[model samples]
Target: MSDESAENLIAVGVHVIVKKHNFSKVYKVSENGTLMLGKNQKVEMHEVVGKPFWSTFEMIPKRGPSKNTYSLRLVERTESLNDLSGLKGQLSGQDNRLIVDYGTSQGLSKDEILRLQEAGKSGKEIIGSLIENSTSFAAKTEYSQEKYIRKKERKYMRFLTVCRPTIVSLHEMYFRQYHEKIGGLRMDALAQILCYSDVQADGLHLLYDSGCQGLPAAAMLNRIGENTSGHLINLHPGNVPQTAIVQAMNFPQELRDRHVAVNIYSFLRLHYQGESSMLDNISTSSKKVTDHIVERSVEKLNGETKSDEVSRTDTDISELETDAGENSTLFLRDAEKDADTLKRKLHEFEEAEEAVPVKKPKWFLETQRALDLLNSSKVRGLTVIAKEHPLNIVNALLPFLGASRPFVIFHTYREPLQETFMELKQKRNAINMRLFTNFLRSYQVLPDRTHPDILMSDTGGYILTGYLVQE
Candidate 1:
């Protein structure tokens, strides 16, 4: 890609879902093909490619009578965070309907309604027509009448606002949509992990994520400002790690370059295979050592044969090759000033070819590189989020962390983290250890009807966090 071409594009492989609300049918700007807007209108990749992030682009009809083709225009942008005080007193509720007021009105036929919906009428216009054609419209109470209009509006709504994707959106898309696969971790829970770990640019952090294609890992990447200079040594149980979530984040190649993956096998080999004495305090029994060595060799052998699988899961280079894949590795900045901030963060990274002793490679499981990273003494933090028990991992890895380095573990059930907390207590290797869960409450905001949502999430998962106090 030329420098001129790169300047005109937004995110290439990243597909932003265009929808009015979370429940609405989403139209995605993906590598699959042109998006079909309402009335069979199609939007090409080029139409969305040049648009700015967070800019709301609407589909307006051409002057001529072609309903299937639309011209894209940047109309406005809305901040995700906005004051709700101005949106109160808008809700209306009613008990019963009145059938006496609309006895003689003639409603439109079903065929007429279908025709109007297919005619590309605006959402307001269609709702108006529906209300006009419903003979019982006047019979409903004011609250019911409002609800009817709202339902019709949602049905006819076609316009969408394109916003920049972040951890909030990812939380909505993955955790809300596929909870079981995502390990039931909520946005606030992940936020707590980042906060407790003190994630920032230029820090070296440890992460273990196997759920939702590195969902936690992707979020950590987002929090660190797309690896301006920070480094994340991602440790996974298997040789071929699932990295779909991180790849979906659309971070720049420079940012993706900051991520390094290590298999538990290679890391154990370096940690306990007589390379260092970190594991010396642990049981020196021959049986345990023999079993560990056997496991490591088996895992390492299995990992070496997974090159093809690793490429499919970890590398985003080939992901956007679909018809709409722009195939550009550059990341788009929302503003010049944001780019300046990232540049300053990356000054140290730019000056040095390798910030950590372990060099980052394009592949996921570079055994030698993984070993080097595991042995590095500069680790500032560690985060564990997995479906399996985290205590075993914490015990094995905490010995290498520098004193005062913090770590966090996330679990849907408190039992796992609770057990890990107790183990830390016994060893006296952690300080300020605490186990807690977060509850999230949301509200329904509208013009004069804002109130708390009827439902709230009871669980944001359990967090057991503490800092390492190396013996």
Candidate 2:
């Protein structure tokens, strides 16, 4: 073919010769346009398509006029082609022009294609990196791989760029799912289990697996020490495992001496038995103290009531009869006195309740810890946003709730649990319960509202949080 013709025929359906040395086995194009040959024989042909971005394509066999008709040669070329012949060669005889054009139309670039090849990375990785980097490209190519990596990676460092905010959003979405649908107990239990599972301790430092896509966990952990009271060291993902050991070793000797707590969350596991034991002791002691206080309060109230009943019964025989004879007047006086006494008693009880130091509910406390860890200097928070999930809601409010220190529960719209939130609200005293709904009007109308001790948000699937607001 003439050079001009060859140039013009660059479009699809062009015919070309195979470079013989590239393949050790001989193969020929079949009538169906697939490659066919002996198991041992091989040959290289010009790719009419492009590189395989995701999957590998295998050549198939076809029947022809000759007994050895497995092999065939192209006799002609077509016009309307583009210059993808070089890429076609690199992609093992696939249709380079077609693939390249498709990718280009989707916003990929030649340089990106090269980088993608050089990195030996998957399409998913390339796409993720591009989005995370927020590469600037033409509108069509904003999400296109070719425009982002080959062009953008040169200007931006993926690791140096900020991804924590987006990751944090995602984390919020996941927690929302947990809080709205899974219930607070399950959410706390899952977090605790994951945290404990990830813990790693050595003589020097403690390492833990903050969990997959850990930016959110790290952000939450950092916020714990700042917003609430806790001692936790947050670690970044890249420096983990090694940095964990270093931190574990270099942890403040003073804190250790004072029996202060040190919590670490990463992918590594804690190796020291002593540290694990310390954590267990703290958990056990706290639980014991709470139980004892509750038990004592119940006993004291019961004792007080029993004594009052005995005194009232003992005084009244003939006096009660005389009082009855002057019944109307005496009864009115006594009823008024009783009402006054009851009012006084109610006021006293309320004051005592207010004076009682409320322990934060487990979910709020744990979530606060996670938020503190996320905000720590050593770690950066990554928010994860999902379209729908309970975990997302929980993660989002975790910081706010921790600040407010409110009790939380999640109830769903379906099954035996249906309308359970409404029932609980009606049954509980107004002071003890507070509900926050997505319904905008309800949020606006409620007056005399103190910040909820228990803050609840719906997952659209269910309601979360019940009981006294902790803050």
lDDT of each: 0.65, 0.33
RMSD in angstroms between candidate 2 and the native structure over all alpha carbons: 29.2
lDDT of 1 at 249: 64
lDDT string for model 2 (21-80, tens) is: 112111222333543333542322333332211112222122333332222223232111
Residue 129 lDDT in model 1?
Answer: 71
TM-score of 2: 0.22
Best by TM-score: 1
- Deviating ranges (above 4 Å) for candidate 2: 1-406, 411-418, 422-471
Off by over 4 Å in 1: 1-11, 23-32, 35-46, 55-106, 226-228, 274-365, 445-451
| Clash count in backbone of candidate 2 | 93
- For every model shown, the clashing-pair count is 6, 93
Q: Model 2 scores what on Cα lDDT?
A: 0.33
Error of 1 at 210 (Å): 2.3
Model 1 residue 320 lDDT score:
41
Per-candidate TM-score against the hidden true structure: 0.67, 0.22
